[model samples]
Target: MVVGATRQSRFLFYVWQILLTAALQGPIKPDPGSQLGGDPWPEWSRSAESLASSEIEQECRQSVDSFLRRAESSLQSPLGSRHPNPRDMLFFLHVPRTAGRTFFACFLKQATPPSKRCAKSYDILRLNVSVEGCGLLSSHDDYSVTAVLPPTATVITQIRDPVDRVLSAYEFAVEVASRHLQVPLGVRTPRPPGKPRVDTRNVWPWSLLVPWMEADMRMRAAKLRSTRDGALKENNTSRREFVRLRGHAGGWAYYHSLASGASKEELSQGDVLLPNLDPYNNPLAMPLREFIEHPIVASTIHNGAALQVLGLTNYSHHRDAAKLRGCVAEVPSVREAMVRVAVQRLQGMYHVGVTDRLQESITSAAGSLGINLTGPAWRGKADAAFEYGDESVAEAEAPTRSDGPYSQLIHLQNQTDAILKELSRKQKELEQLRQSSYNSGSANAVSACFSLRALPASA
Candidate 1:
């Protein structure tokens, strides 16, 4: 019996050693490199690459989450050690073509007093003035030390897909130009003729104008950097130093000259202007091809010059190949590091509590003003069947429907139905939440104001 037991024990020991060896060798073993050159394509390297990407994404998220948590805690504390003055407000650093309009409408309604509700955009720019006693100030101005608010002020901003923003901007510029030429050449109503007024509604072709736009953006960025760095004269009275007045006023001549090195006649009357010239017939204007070719603009518009100028750094543009490639080139080790931190930070800070609180604030304020939070009621039924007759025909033809092929189709359909239902429910819930938030915010603001008024002015 003793001999038999020893033999069994030895067999088990051998099995353990084999497993240990295999475990150690599995990861380090070199299989034939998937690609011809041994450097894996993105897809080929996905297994290993994804692991790295995920790690980086996670680290970046975490870092952002931590930073926001610290900021939120600072805002919420009653001791006021982190945020000394409750009156010190948060500016919604508006990045044009983002969701800034919706946010600003909501924010203004909550912050502004009923008497001063119609305050102009200029009124919002002045730093020292209390915005209807909410103390918040915001503008789409370039970065300047003089423009800086108190450090206690929490500046928040939103970012959008840059390519989309640029496309939208182009469309807007075109619309403005068309509107200016209302009496198109031979129209009966000969309108007062002048340069077209630039507004948010015009359509402009950005692809042909890309080089020009890029030059403008670069100049803006350089100017901003100089001003921020104190290289520009402190007393530089040029409004361009403070705000993007040139672009707003239809001064693309400078950029055009810089980009194409072409005379004004060449720019206005050349083949290059074909895209913008015939706005109605252009197919490129509809789907926006710039996203495919010029992805860097997406990053630049959202987080680069725009954010820096607005003094908001919390939001980030979506990741693109350029960002990934740059990180890979500059600091390969830390390439993944920053992304991971941001992901972690976002998850930690942007929680249910913050969203809930914000919603409550929005609802309460809106309710007091009798503004209906529900804009347009959703008309579709919860269980409306989606028409997929022809679409389903191709899906039904697979032979192995029972397990691998058909099961996937069934699962996908189920998921789609489930997601639609969830989305519908969420939309309804969102409307209610917004109403509640406005109410809560109004009450809080009034309470804060009253409390402040009661205190000794000197104190």
Candidate 2:
């Protein structure tokens, strides 16, 4: 009996040795290039590129369980029995020029715990972003990004006054253009007695200049559209020529045409900023009056109704909120029902904050979305860190921007005074349109070519 027991023990030992050998030969070593900047205790990677779906789900479960433990621990004080809704995921739709970067920093600080990770990037939406991994995700995108989210995901967004927003966008583009050149054109002002401050850098498109003299721009755009419509579907020499001609509508031409005079071949690399034209100023420049009637102006007024960019003919122009007016009214070619549906979808968003009222907006969002953040920091005034135009030392030093210079010339304060004056006039014009007593019952306001006839109060 003793001999038999010894033989059995020997067999078990042999089996254990084989198992140990196999494990040593092929041990579990983490990928050398693994994205691993999350909770050290948690077995999750930010990218999750090397993990299987099952592994991802496991990691998610672990993370969620840990989250729940932390949440439940907060409630154990015997103060209240009411359970807070621990929302699975939250999304921030980062619109351009909306103080989004400043707000984003606050959001990240408020979101992830001291140890937990927060995943941020436009690319995060490319993956199947789930609530299981982490609670936060943000991007510079529209409603289309919803496809990748789980049902528990809540959306947050901020909207800016379209006129100010556009101006901000334009100036940012100019800065990018200056940076793109070998020797940047931006003027650096001397810092005051205080230490130089660092500011959040934003990702913005460098050369999306909306044309001046709306009439000329529209005429060119229309002519180009007509030519394209009549052309063949296949690529040919005519197509190539047409494409080259289209390049003339880019930023370099816009800047040079206004600055001095640009030729067809004078486009800068990335076609961002062009070489300054000779004479530095032109007598035959297009006036603000001519630009007031541009199609983009009309498109801006009517674009508010579109919830989905796919519905609008020009995705860029139609991004503005037309206060829920229908695109069909402006672009009669589109279907009324479709436009209505788009409007309805936008109206259905969880939260949309006006940029001017950011503090109230975000606080309200936290309550409605069940995020537990509550502090004076989250509820800042207009001059708080969440506000735009407060980050730069130059901006602090520069006096109230007047339409004194055309585009803001950092050097010569009153340089390009012609366009600066035009911009001032344009601001008032856009404001008038924004506050217009237009026909609200009709859905067409989203993208319609609206006239400036002031409707009587009775109407």
lDDT of 2 at 421: 48
Tens digits of per-residue lDDT for model 1, 62-151: 434454454345435311123313344444444555545455554443444333332222211233232324344444432221123443
Per-model CA lDDT versus the true structure: 0.34, 0.37
State which candidate has the highest TM-score: 2
lDDT of 2 by residue, 229-329 (tens): 45534433232221111121222311222112233555454444422211111111222233234333343322322332222222221222121122233
Q: For candidate 2, which ten residues in a row score worst on lDDT? A: 393-402
- Model 1's alpha-carbon lDDT is 0.34
Clashes of each: 59, 16
List where candidate 1 sits over 4 angstroms from the true fold: 1-86, 114-126, 129-134, 140-147, 159-287, 291-299, 302-459
**Could you tell me the lDDT of residue 442 within candidate 2?**
50
